[model samples]
Target chain A: MIEIQTDPLLYRVQKPEVRERFEALKQRPVVLSVQNLYKTFESQTGTVTALKDVSFDVYRREFMCVIGPSGCGKSTLIRILAGLESSSDGKVLLDGNPVTGPGPDRGMVFQSYTLFPWLTVKQNVMFGPRMSGKRGTSAESEARQWIDLVGLSKFENSYPHQLSGGMKQRVAIARALANRPRILLMDEPFGALDAQTRCQMQSYLLQIWRNLDITILFITHDLDEAAFLADRILVLKANPGEVNEIIEVPVPRPRSAAQFITPEFIATKYRIDQLIHPDQGSPEDALPFPRMTPQGDDVE
Target chain B: MLTMFSFSLPLLAWCAVSYLPFLWHPDVELQISADREGVTTVYTPGDRVSEEFFPEFEAAVRTQNEEVSPFMSLDKPVEAGSESSVRRSNKKVLRHLAPLLVSNGWLTEEQTKDDAAIYVAWKEIATGARLPEQPALTEENLEIVRKNWALMSRYSDSYNADNFVSRPLLSLVPQGRPANPDYLPAPHRVLISGFKEFTKPAEAERPSMWQRVGHSMRIVFGGFLLAALVGVPIGVICGTYSFFSKLIEPFTDFFRYMPAPTFSTLLVVIFLANDAPKMALVFIGTIFQLILVVANTTRRLELPLLEAAQTLGANQAQLLTRVVIPGILPNLYNDLRILLGWAWTWLVIAELVGVKSGLTEFIETQGRWRNFDSVYPVIILIGLIGFFTDQILSFIRGFIFPWTSEGPAITSTPVAKVLLFVPRWFKSAVDERIPYQPESTSPNKA
Candidate 1:
């Protein structure tokens, strides 16, 4: 076995101010709690563990991000929290009550486009309330307000197919918020968008969170995304996924694009990167292809 | 321009085969006909025979005329006992000239039935008083007509049944023009015959063309509505739940493979000789396919939509009605449109069974008599009805499911504007009842 040295600068140590802020956040009422969560799948190859002994807590009005590698069960955890999937061994509590199945209290937005193609933006936003037995006029007005909040009032009568990808996701966000859920569970909701749109959406999401009295559990694979918006980040390990660390982001509040270059933001992103890519190094030495380039013609 | 060419190409091809005689005219249609001695086969002026057989027919009539001339010129012309029989034969010969007289426009159709009028027309033609222009008499036929009239005038100045039988009349030689066989009537002939048939008054035993068309429409629509009524709900259930899908789809898949028409005999026996059996055949033909198609369309609905609805507090019943139904409706409408066309394929086979009703029945009867002109009209009518119905349905689909991106947006043509009136009015009416008024333009601040 080869020995590897850990990067001393990126070590898992919380500064005094960050710890104090975290302590203050914990004093608020818990909105969601997960205890010893486990999920497994039965396949032809035999049973495979997808998640193992995961635990976490989210306070009221908290903005939490779960960041991990591809197979780290980030989706499975979000699904279980949203009551879209059942855990093999765990308990999920929302406001001290057990999470049984999906309800209006936990609004979900998927990574894939999920807006009903047959309904206009306004109608899609009205759907949740309508299903809960709210009549037309009330539902319509509430839907209109939500549409306005998402900055999509002009497109309220447009179908999903007519909207661009980012606009569609915004409509989806408005649709979810219309239900007045206690918490929003977003599973990489901007993952499919372009880089520019993704940044815009991150800012839009942060603004929405600031305005509303709502808690959010956002899942992403991008370290920059988590560091930019999250109050705290939950990092997990792959291969029977388990929690690696819960970092209280050292970045200042009211985040802007200018703060992305700050030392605290860089340190938080570096810690997530180290956790997700612990074996990271140059991969060229592992490749079997023989070098065919002329001497001293380096690209780096 | 392409649409015009699509229809005109076939019509142009038909015209080529019809009016351009040099293309393919294997037979000769008779303009004037004759009777053969000792042969009972009577050829009419419009009857067609093979090109090779026309000369033999003409020769036979000429031979019979030669054999009769010598007997008539003899001094002792007749026997009293057989004079009536001779007069009867002469009367038959004069009646043969009736068709020729009508074609020349000298005699009306009803006047052809009057024996005295036919006698006068033949006298005028022989005397060169009335000239037939459209189909001028050949020199040989005119000579035969004069000889026959000379023999007839010797017996009577006007038609007298007793005097008309005094001697035998010479038959006109057969003459003809190159023509196609009777089964493939010319396009103009078909148009003329079709017009007459449609305008003809209904008789005691026969229904008019319009009635037959109405009957056919009833069968197709009745069967389709019934299938949609029953199949949509079952298909939706099958599509929604795995338990129902497994329970129903396997058998339906199996049943769809068995041809619908194969059950026609059974339907006829069960329903007993009326419209019921025909409608039942169409229903059976359509329902199995409808259920399978609708179920598949329902299955194709993306899973994300359902999951999203579930997370938004939709219960099982709510998921089906609000999410599943609305999600599959555009595709379902499209499927039903195609299946309605499928149902029409059964119409011909369905109407053929159990008492033979509708336009197909008319086609069958006219085709049996080799009246192909009449048959073409009914067959074309069925095709036109199916084509226009499908086109209109496709046009209306854009209005019914406006959210779908598959078809063109509704245009502002006069017909489209008229069709849009009802839906627009209904939407405005609904809008009025809802008291909430949204801001016309809300600025986006995010």
Candidate 2:
């Protein structure tokens, strides 16, 4: 077996105090635990394994980000944790109980704008509470608190169609959070936003995470976003996807856009890029297209 | 302005065809008429003949009148054996002047049937006491009236049926004006006839126009409401679950193609001869299409809405009632509106099947008699009913589904306010029930 520290791609730079921070994080009780999870889909070409021997734990109040290249089964893994899809083998436990199906204990936010169009922002937020048998004024008051938490109190009465893309997602986040779940499962929740809006959302999410006691398992394919938000990053590989490595994000928190170029943040993002793109060479050499442009040094 | 023009254009066309006498009056409507000696067909005033035939008719009557005059001067007393026939023929001559007298406002409609009153009117006209103004009597017709009255006064000064003149009166020459066919009456004639038909009291067994209108509305609304009641739930179920869709849609798809009218005889047999069968046909005509349309609309509900509800910890029942129902409501409402129009297309056929009833029945009867002036009003009324109902429903849709962008923005009109009042009140009532909490106050500031 190759020595991990000796491998150039596996080298990680970290702050001197990062080891103590990691030890403290590990002491927190596990809120969600996955054991030997496997998922297979029966396509026309017989059974195809989507995820194989996937296992990870999300500690209480911890912010974990799962990053991978395309087709890495990151979405499938998050869906399984959300109880939207079932694993072919192994188990998912929330706290101490086995997760059989979607419940109020696990809240979910999708990449798409999933706010109920017919309902107002407040009504959309109140939906989970109402479904669990909270009705009338009490549900409305609780929903208002969440709307307040997401900083969308002004738009509480406006319908989803009346709101902008960022505002709609904010309502969606408010709706998911209103359930008061132990863990929040997000499947690339900011994937569809513009870059500026996405950056703003990342900061907003970090602020919300700091204030609430809720744990989050966020899935994304962006290395910078993983480094910026996650206390620890879980990297996944494709073709019968499996866990490649779990990196402790050594960038000190109270993070801002200013920290994006810090030595610790850059080291963390670079390590993720290497793992997700292991064979990155000159892609132009593989293309057989004939070049029709005039030969000139000015093109570069 | 355009809506007004759309309606007025048709009205203008109709008026042009009706009032323009020189345009296409192929036949002549008689103002004065006479009978032939050997012919069984008696032509009366207001009867129409081809313009070519009018002159021949006048010549025949004039030739017969010459023969009658020479015979009357002979003063041959009528035989007792032929007295009744002679009186009958003279009475017919007297009635010819009745149409002219009625138009001059000298006789009432009831008096035209009274031979005694007609006898008196003849004396008045011959004596120049009652002069016909609009269609003044021709010199020739006036001479024939005076000669006939001279002979009639010899029997009695006033009309007495027993002593009525027992000799044939001289027939007046036929006179007429150019006119359209009997089926294409002038606009004023149609308006007058329509007014009479509407205001006419229910005579013995016949119903009034209002009753017919009410009955027609009942058939359409009853059948449509029943179909909606039954079809909406089934459609929603089929749309919500694939198992239900596979089980129900295939059969419904097959059933819709069989044609609802084909089952008319079967419906009549099962429901018997009444409104039941007619309504059943409408129900059948509407329900199958409604199911398919509503199912398709429900299926079109965004999948993300359903998945979102599922993740919100909603159970199966809550998902259906809260999410699926509300999510598909606006579209389903639109589908039902369109399907209601589909239901109306079956009305004419449905009403004809067994024990014909409603406006369709009236249209069929009047149409058969070729009284198109009377038929026009009923047909127009049905069209107006459908048009106005659709327009009103479309307007109300804006108030009902304010969330949908297809509708106009909600306004503060009184009707809209009244429509929106109940839901708003209910929401506010729920809000009021919460206990006051000072710490949670001004949540927006958070």
Candidate 3:
């Protein structure tokens, strides 16, 4: 009785050979694994549980998106993976090593523009390499390559204050990538941008991910963004927030924003939506009331 | 434009009211002449008749001149112009002279006459005649007589000129020429030390005003540098760590309240009686405030930036040098500039400790002698230097920290350029210590 064999929809959407390849890839190696993670915040008021019993695994070079409604601890989960926040219970392992605190191995992009204002665009990209003890002509050339990769070659000498919102984010991405970390953690990187800039950034991010071959864990509230960008989506439930389900999108790779209108994309979004709000009707017949997904004993 | 006009209206009114009446007056020129050996004399062009016959009146009127006057008899009026007119003018001088002489017991009231009696009394007094109850003629008493005579001379001259009330304000700005040298020597006359014969030898012994100002600057710079060296580090430590902040807080707070100059006794004991004590006074005056100001400024540095640097693999020292120090520099520079001005105030207090050759010391000695001509310029010179120092510091701040909007400036000087490159050199030094990992050529390179 194979558990994966019971899921017929997944089999129908993905050819058997492709499904076999995915199952093989899943077993290849676990780059990052979280086990029963819990985070509690205690203040003058009573303690509020921000995350509870959260568990997931990310494969090498995979694009994973975590989506949840507001106050569902989506950000907390990503922050924990970034080693910026520690989990109260259980542990996180990055490539077989226990996660302790922020280190050079994991690069993070915050929702706010965190580019060093005192540094120029080139200097900001070079910061990681320089701080880690890389100097001279070679390190500079490497920094320039990353800057050029982010399409900010002409703005190498410009300070962060001189750059626009989107440009500043690009520099931040370049800065993080310059260190060449194994995994990239983005916490609502495009959340502050306008709708048009957000769409453009989403496309640029996808292009960079494809080119870099680096694993990514992106957190966003937008379902469409998750459906368009994720290889697998982690859905979380609020009020002592915990992972509801982890659903894989069986869509073809090398996709663009145009694929968002396709049937497969819509179906994957619908499935995730149902998993999030099982009691509510389909997204088209969306109820005015708040959606609350039923809790399930779904752990992997 | 209207706001500017409103702001300037009061200043314009003050200038107009202060000087317009003086501008309207004509023939306000009054030549004050003094015979080199005898008393200084002043002669107004409007009173030529009196000027010709009454050289004694000329000598008496110019109050500031301290030269001893020769005893001249009124019976023999100077042989100038007509004899009858000279005698007539002699009677006018006699009336003014009579009251002063009678008060000093030089002449008895019984001897007073309507016309020629004063001339007869003057002759008698000049020949050493003394009253029955007259006090002994000592030097002090004779000095008092000379001052009284000068006072009467001024009263008679002004009373005779008649235009005293409407005298031009421009001529009264205290230049040497238009004023009576014996009276209030004009400001310029007091200033002209080049005529060294007139100036006291003691006044000649001091260094020039500019040299004294330079001494003040050297003391201020020494104190300011020491304060910065000691204070900035303490501030940085207190700001970055909570333990140090709590530990240093009470002392810094208490010391700021206690006046700095009050430490002069302790400073003299510690630094000894020399330049050290004076500079120590300035150092103590500014260091405590500088520490607190810089500490407060350092505490305000954004925490996220520090976290960001920490995640970037920066150690504690690197984080301070690269992020925290640079982050607080612009504001710290502003704090130092303001504190430097405060240090200048301490210069007056500091120079009082032991050194008596600084600008403030020069001011003190000159003030005692009332040579305000040199004093006022020294004060203005201090102000100018302070203003210019502030300007130059701000200018350099901009050149060094161009990233900040406050100092949105760039370096052109070779020294400033070298200083700006120091961080890069420091970064390279930091880089050299960390082991380098050869990066794999990623297939992702496009």
Candidate 4:
């Protein structure tokens, strides 16, 4: 755990009430907690246990990121939570209620842009709301709001074919948000984006969080992305994916892209790098999925 | 001698096949029976128009003699000799159909009316001569206009004014032609004029040419429309859902390979009991082909589109409606383009089974009496009309899906942002991920 710099945005934030509410919101208990979760798939080749006993707790307004190397169960865990894939073992608690199936209360944003090709952007966004039995003026208003929130106001009437990749992804994000889920699950949501667009989306995501403060459980293979948007980063190891360590990131609120250049940022990055690649320092650090050595254990 | 050899081959083959143990005898002689009111003639060979529609054929001969005798001949272009009635009537139809299609977006509207003047002045020797270029219209637009004129001219030649009103000998001599003892043309409908005993049709039997063409064209067109209507929705459904795709695909695949004649046979047996067997046959044939189209379209729902729909919090029903159906339009249009021929292939088979109507039955009638000449032209009419129907449907596809042509042409590869070093696959991946907004890029994020 590193002590974080004061959130740079705290100085510029003009609302005193928001600042007070933010602190009060931090005091709220964890709404959903995932503990010692594990998942394995039985394929034709053999049983591939993709996730090992992973643990994390998400409080309201917290934005947590699960980052690891490829083949680590970051996406698998998200999929399990999304109800797309069943977990071999473990339970997910949403507001202390066990998640037995997918519900509108837990919105998931996929990495791929999965818009209905025929539907215009507004209709695609309206889809979930309509299915949930929300209709007429209320549905239309909510659809318009979300479309604008994703910054797709101009493209609301355009078909998916007419939109670019970024626009499609934005509509996906808006669709998820329109559900107003208590927990937002994003599985490497920006991994497919270009470097520039990924940063833009990240900032937009952060801004939206600042407004709505929904609990976030994001999975990423990129360390920089994990560091930028994550409140706490959980690193996982490959080969029967398991969480190695839960690193607390104390970087102040409202960090910008420029903050990545700070010395402290580099130091934290080096430490994470050391955990992922132990040969950079001592061999003893190479233990899989992190088990702390007993007090007097010798370093190899 | 060559004609005799050409005509006898099929008859010989049929006779040999009929004798084989497994093969059945086909005594299918085509015949046209007559009513007291209308004339009937046996098949023969001087000309098809003259033999098939007797009174109309005779009328055409008389009209041609009176209308195109000395000056109004088809020998020269309108520009070459004196522009005559033969040329003028054809030019009128050509100009009318061309502008009609262009105004309706079936053809490209000319940017300038200069094309009309150019077409009016066309000649064989001077077909490529440069004309006045005083307008601000682009050369490309002019080229399109000029090509349109050439099309109009080509069509203008095909509809000879003298041939439009042919009178057949059948209607002229409904009682039957008198046998010329010296020229015993067993085929029928020949008047050795001075022989008072020659066959002549009762005065009431003659019908108009336009009426017959109108009737046949309606049936042909109705069959085309039935295929389009039934096939398009099935295509949309199969394209939209994996479940529908799973259920519909195998059967459609199996049926498509089965010879269309088999379906026609089955259809003839079942539909022969129906009140309107011709309509039923068209329905059966169209449905068979449409089912295939639906299945093929199911296979082309854009991959990204499916993924995108799932990401949108879409449940099963929404998934089917939004992502699956619309993504496969291009594929559907293409499948219909292919299946149109299949439906029409069965058109002949279906029509041939005990049908007294349609060109197929008419051709069969000519065949029974050895009217080889009439049969060939009817067969040619079938092919030409099928081709024409395909063109019309393809035109409709173009109008509905304008992006289809432009898409594969202009969008296969976009201009690269960096020099050639960037891998195309990598670029495509980036293109998929990145949001398109110029503002989304943070000033220094790149």
Cα RMSD of all models vs. native, in order, equals 5.1, 6.4, 14.1, 23.1
Model 4 has an lDDT value of 0.59
Score chain A of model 1 by TM-score against the reference chain A.
Answer: 0.91
DockQ of each: 0.41, 0.30, 0.23, 0.11
lDDT of each: 0.87, 0.85, 0.70, 0.59
Model 3 Cα lDDT, one tens digit per residue, B310-371: 56666777788888888888889999999999999998888888656677777788678766
**In candidate 1, what are the lDDT values of residues B1-446, reduced to their tens digit?**
99999999999988898899898989999878877768888778888999999999989988888877765663756666887777777777888777877888878989877889888877888898986776778898889888888877777768876557467778788878899998888999899989998898878788888988999999999998999999999998888898999999999999989998899899988998898988898899999999989988999999989999999999999999899999999889889999999999999998998788878888888898999999887778889999999999988887777788775666455887887799889998988888776654422221
- TM-score per candidate: 0.84, 0.78, 0.68, 0.57
List clash counts for every candidate, in order: 1, 0, 7, 31
- Candidate 2 lDDT by residue in tens digits, B333-379: 88988988888888899899888888888889999988989998887
- Name the 10 consecutive residues with the lowest summed lDDT in model 1 chain B: B437-446
Q: Is candidate 1 or candidate 2 better by lDDT?
A: 1
- Per-candidate iRMS values, in order, are 4.2, 4.0, 5.3, 8.9
Pairs that collide, model 2? none
- How many backbone overlaps does candidate 2 show? 0
**How many residue pairs in model 4 have overlapping backbones?**
31
- Mind sharing the TM-score for model 2? 0.78
Model 2: per-residue lDDT, tens digit, A1-300? 222332343225444577778888899999999999999999999999999999899898899999999998999998888788899998999997999987878889999888887888988999998898888665677777888888998988888878888788888888888888889889899999999999999999999888888899999988888999999999999988999999988788789999987667777877888889889743565668675667674453
B100 Cα displacement, candidate 4 (Å): 45
Docking quality tier of model 3: acceptable
Model 4: docking quality category? incorrect
